[model samples]
Target: MAKLYFRFGAMGSAKTLNLLAVAHNYRQQRKKVLLIKPQIDLRFGANAITSRAGLTCDADLLVSEKSYFTLKGNDLISHDSLKKDQKNEIVLDNKLDYSCFLVDEAQFLTKELVEALYEITILCNIPVIAYGLKTDFRNFLFEGSKRLLELSDTIEEIKTTCFYCEKKATHNIRLIGEKPVFTGETVDIGADEKYRPCCKMCLHKLKSR
Candidate 1:
């Protein structure tokens, strides 16, 4: 049976790179892979799924909080066709014959969307791999990550070392002008300069200062 897989890591753990590599492997084997990303992640571009190492690919599907999915025969429909009100939803007429579905920045996804992806894996018999940070800078579980942890058939952690030490990093520290700050909006989108991966001790040390 196909499984819903959640691969999470702290900031700078190369989650996006891993996702891109998986997609490449699938395509190299003559299999189709669908790339998906949350519409909120515009760090690279509106539709670009970019890795920090410089590799990039256009996302086939850009999902938002208002987006939902339904299987219509062998195809997947993004919005409800019967519902006359399609206000903020993205409508897509895409076939669901892909061998795999890969999602980047999965933490930004809404809980409802995560549930829909989980359902797709079972109903469509297609494996879904979602890569993202397990927790926010505030050490809180993201809505999507929380649901994935609960529903995914396989949960894996992509490991990386702490920025200040050789120990493994388990948390993210939000930064502004090289100084760590704990108080801010939950979803401040920025790359390397804005966040640092820290271990428990280093995180606590930084917080105490």
Candidate 2:
């Protein structure tokens, strides 16, 4: 049976790049793979996933919370060639007939979407893989990440060193201008300029003094 996999990381941990690599692996084997990204991430325009290392490809599907539910047997999708048009044409409904579902920036997903994803593997026989930030800037659980933690068959953390201390970082620090701030919505679209990865010790120490 296919499994639901959640791979999470802090800022600058190459989550998207890893997700893309997985896609490449599947395609190289002649297996159908779908690349999905939440519509909320527009840092590189709509329907595109661009890694900081310059690896990029157009997303097969740009989805929101409702993509999991938009399918209700309306799809006439056949064969396993996995064309990009097939993805955009099929409405996301409870009936998951696809080979695989992959989501990037999954931290933006809603709780309902995550639950539906859990069902995709168990009840619908579709494998689901999601990659995203594990925690927000304020060290709180993103609704999507929280749900994934509870429902995922396997949870993996992608590790990287802290931006300032060179320690193993587990947190994403948000910067407004030149200074760090602990405030804001969970999803902010900024690359390199607005976020930093920090270790737990540095996080606590920075917040304290």
Candidate 3:
């Protein structure tokens, strides 16, 4: 039976790099892999799935909160609300041709979308691998990650060291310039200049200062 797998970690953990490597291995074996990413992640580009390590790939599908999925015959079709023309709907038909479904930045996905991916694993018999941060900078579980933790057949952690020390990083700290700030919007998208991965002790020290 195919399984829904969630691999989550703090920032700079190379989650997207790992995802790219998996996609590479599948394609190398002559198997088809579908790449998916949330529409909210524009850090690279609208359709680009990029890693900090400089590896990138265009996502096969971009999903938003308004997107939905349905199975037709052997095909999985996604109906997206990205178009302003109400009469013409945009559809992505996945004819069950792919051996696996790989989603990047899975934390930005809506709960409904995660459930749809889960259904694909069971009904379509395709394994789905989702890579993302488990929580936001505030250390709160993202809606998508929360559902994945509850429903995923397997949950794994991708490890990375704290920015200040060698301890394993467990939390993401948002920064403006060089100082850590605790209060802000939950969904601020940024790279190294705006965020740092910190262990529990380092986080406490920074917050105490």
- CA-lDDT, candidates in order: 0.87, 0.80, 0.87
Order of models, best lDDT first:
3, 1, 2
Clashing pairs in 3: none
lDDT for predicted candidate 3 compared with the true structure:
0.87
* Candidate 2 global lDDT: 0.80
For candidate 1, write residues 57-116 as lDDT tens digits. 999988887677755532233444435454344433364678999999999988878877
Each prediction's TM-score against the native? 0.92, 0.85, 0.91
Off by over 4 Å in 2: 70-98
Q: Flag the better candidate by lDDT, 1 or 2.
A: 1
TM-score ranking of the models: 1, 3, 2
Off by over 4 Å in 3: 73-93
Top model by TM-score, which number?
1
Cand. 3 TM to true fold: 0.91
Q: Write the per-residue lDDT of candidate 2 for residues 48-140, one digit (tens) a residue.
A: 898888999888877664344434653332323444443434355533545688889999987766876786677667899999888899989
What is the clash count of model 3?
A: 0
